[model samples]
Target: MSETVREKANQSLAMVEEVTAVVLPEPAAANAVVPLEKANKTQSAEIKRRMAEIDMEDTQSIVSFGSAAQAELQEISQAMLADVRNKDVGPAGDSLRSIVSTIRGFSVSELDVRRKRSWWEKLLGKAAPFAKFTAQFEKVQGQIDRITDNLLSHEHTLLKDIKSLDMLYEKTLQFYDELALYIAAGEAKLADLDATVIPAKEAEVSKAAEADQVMVAQELRDMRAARDDLERRVHDLKLTRQVTMQSLPSIRLVQENDKSLVTKINSTLVNTVPLWETQLAQAVTIQRSAEAANAVREANDLTNELLTSNAKNLRESNKMIRQEMERGVFDIEAVKQANADLIGTIEESLQIADEGKAKRAAAEKELQEMEANLRDTLAAAKAKKTGLGDTAGGAVPG
Candidate 1:
């Protein structure tokens, strides 16, 4: 073969090498199955402790220091929210924010009542954590959402670029075929020209083919550079996707934890606080009633003692008057008048004592009823506390 033909053949082989630049190896399945991060043991443990169902201890604290305990509870919820909010989304920030907007809305009421919580109020409080979790979940979910989009986008772009390169490879291969044929035909003409009178037209044709081969080589080099860039981008995108996907489970686990914690806080707020408040109020009321009843009983006893003394004194005076009459030294009219006044006074004293006794009995009975109610309330509160404490466990696993 002519030196020029040999050169052209070598150039065509180089273009073939450039064309292979566009072809990418299949990414390992292991890459897609990236190991996900687990929830932080410390954070998970803290969540369990803080969000545990309201127990007897919590109820006592709320009852003893209502506002202070509530403030502490609020601080915990706020801290959880803040912690989740502070997590870095890095390049996934935009995607995460967008996702959060579409999720369920979270709203916390700052309107905490200073007075005792009612049964209904406490029940409603249990839902508060849901709001907090919703807030946290939305934030994290948004990041996950963006991460997903990026993964898909990168994959799509990589696939599109690979397809473009494949088409280019085929076109370049065809060009190689045409250049080989031209080189062969040109070499044949050069050999024939050497044997006979050299022709300018044959020389020009060979020269033009050589020029075309040079241009084709440059095109192959440019395509090779482009394919190299595309491959690098694909590889980087795959890694990013894997990391992001792996990170997802960990984030989701945290979200699940947030949900669990919120549920517990709400339970404590609704069940423990309200029940404790009601129990305390009822106890106070019962005590007050008992005190009032005791006072009425004491007053009744004193009244009866005074009435008995007055009766005894009247009886003694009557006995003296009778003795005077018996001794024949008393006025009949004075004795009759004295007897009438004493009888009337005695009847009034007996009537007043009867009314006092009746009132004291009624007060005692009412006091007993109040005490009974208070006892029952306390028992119910205790049972609820025990039940809630037992039921509250760790957050549901993701």
Candidate 2:
């Protein structure tokens, strides 16, 4: 056998030893002890006995110890990959975002429960500000309930994913153990072929006559081919084992992620949702108290304005009444002043008449001058026309 093939076989044996140490620990009985060399010889004898049972004409049986192991590993791998591909935490994340958004959308200010009432509404006691707030609260509560339901649904899904990952993790370990056994068996068969079977066959080929030498050599060649094929199969199994080793940790990590998501969902459901609802209830109660206080303050302000306005009107009415009552119906001083005013008015009217007469005479004289100027201008224009006509008539021959 080549050094590379020997090294690979040694590596596979070491891996199998490690797996055996882990899976099947030694008994603690002090009297139960076996020599290492003796144990190895026993194992080699069993491997050789198994190999001997395989017909040289059919080498397939030599590597058929765990023929279905590869297919089983492939099935496990496909299942794990499908799970990894399908696992999604996006819905849970979306549920959390929606919860936050819904909580944010809820606002006491939007409810407008503290809006001031009109004068008529206040007088009739018809204001119902809290009605709208109650209606809006019910709507927001429904949204919160829906979000909680969605969160619970995601929680359930995450839990199921965790369980599925647990199964896959177990399946991977099972395959890992099986591959260890398969590799150990293949390595044992290869070692026996290289160390004992092939050398014996080569010796036979050298001693045989020319006619039988070719047949012996051909059998030796067939044995070597079978050994090569077994080696390649063992190497392929080791690769598959490595894949299972890698898959173990990957499965665990995915399970951890799912478990963490479940924890978050539980926290939100058990702690956050109840606390949020409590806070919301407290907020509504506080808002109602604030609205009541505001309404009282507004009423006080309206009363103050009415009182100030009525007092001002009363003072003005009393002052007018006192002034009217203190005055006489007709005083002598009032009659004398009225006679003086009548004389002054007549004299002023006479002075205005004289001024108007003088203004009319001046306006008549200006108008007569304007008419005289206009007649002179017309006479001059007619004389200029007649002179021009006579000059034209004298210039003509006929």
Candidate 3:
């Protein structure tokens, strides 16, 4: 045979060997075990071995159904007469005769089997059909098994590759989830600083607006302290952003590597798309979510800087209003103007904050929806993979 044909044949044989083998149950009694252990294994193995050797082309089997008036029937009658004083029927004889007829129907018939068979057929499932066709059906199936055995033999390299691919995906998801969680935490912190803590500190600055010479100095000092605290917090955020950003490229690279694995796993799914295509869906969904998250993070980063600057400006403006209020030259109209300015600042900042929140919420929801889909797809893939393995490895032999 040509190398290609030989390879194909080997592939087919490997499939059978990997996918199908009979296992015997433990013996019921100790004595039975001693007698039956090797015998049972040997018998089952022989059946499979014979099947593997079957030649579909130029193979033939014939079987003949016997007539009721065969030589065995007359011989049975003569043996019965010698055993009995009179010609008679007995329960034992009737049961024996029935058993004999049933056995003869299959065992004593001329062997019959098929001729040519495809390389894809299984040979061992034809035991019962030997009566109708012939044993060639079993023989063709055996050839198919032989071919399957070579391709799917023990230590299949493909299985190892699949496991390696699965490991890569596992790492990819871990990074995706970790990065998402870190960003979410940072967003929460930014929101807290912008909306609650910073605003309260600014309100404190405003309250101290009416200080005299010494008090005005004291108030300015407090304002500076608040600014310093907020600045430090902003600095910390920048540091965190640096760390997270640095890690992102590595994460993205890992995600990219996972794409190749997804391709390999999908090819393995073959016709079982509905069942085993989870990896493809998971990899695609995560990639999209990571992309969206990266975009959102970039936006939020700019917003963070804007918030820091705005807070600083608000603190300075507040300090100035305090100094004027304490100067006793505080006109009623001036106070009103200060209040109006404060309201304007609050409204604009609140709007920006709200928009940021809405965007983050929407992005998070999308991520969550995709996560649910990933789980469902993974389950289907696992089930389908299991089924494919079982079908090839668990077929019974003739």
- For model 3, the superposed segments whose C-alpha errors exceed 4 Å read 1-158, 208-398
lDDT of each: 0.43, 0.69, 0.42
Clashes of each: 4, 0, 37
Let me know the TM-score candidate 2 reaches against the reference structure: 0.59
Give the 10-residue window scoring lowest on summed lDDT in candidate 1.
30-39
Off by over 4 Å in 1: 1-30, 33-210, 319-398
Residue-level lDDT of model 3, residues 1-398, one tens digit each, is: 12453454345444333322322122122112111123356544433342233221212210011111123333433433342333122332333344334323433222212233334444543333223223432333344333323322211433333343344334433333333333333333344546775666556666664654556555546544544443444344334334434444443343333333333322222222222224334433554565567678889999999999999999999999998788756778899999999999999899989999999999999999998777656666665777755454344333
Reference-based TM-score of each model: 0.30, 0.59, 0.19
Shift in Å, residue 398, candidate 3: 99
* Residues 282-366 of candidate 1: C-alpha lDDT, one tens digit per residue: 5445545655676799999999999999999999999999887787455778899999999999999999999999999999999
Best by TM-score: 2
Clashing pairs in 1: 96-142, 96-143, 122-270, 126-266
Better model by TM-score: candidate 2 vs candidate 3: 2
Give model 2 RMSD, 1 decimal: 21.8
Q: Sort by lDDT, best first: what order?
A: 2, 1, 3
Better of 1 and 3 by TM-score: 1
Q: Which one wins on lDDT?
A: 2
Residue 339 CA displacement from its true place in model 2, Å: 24
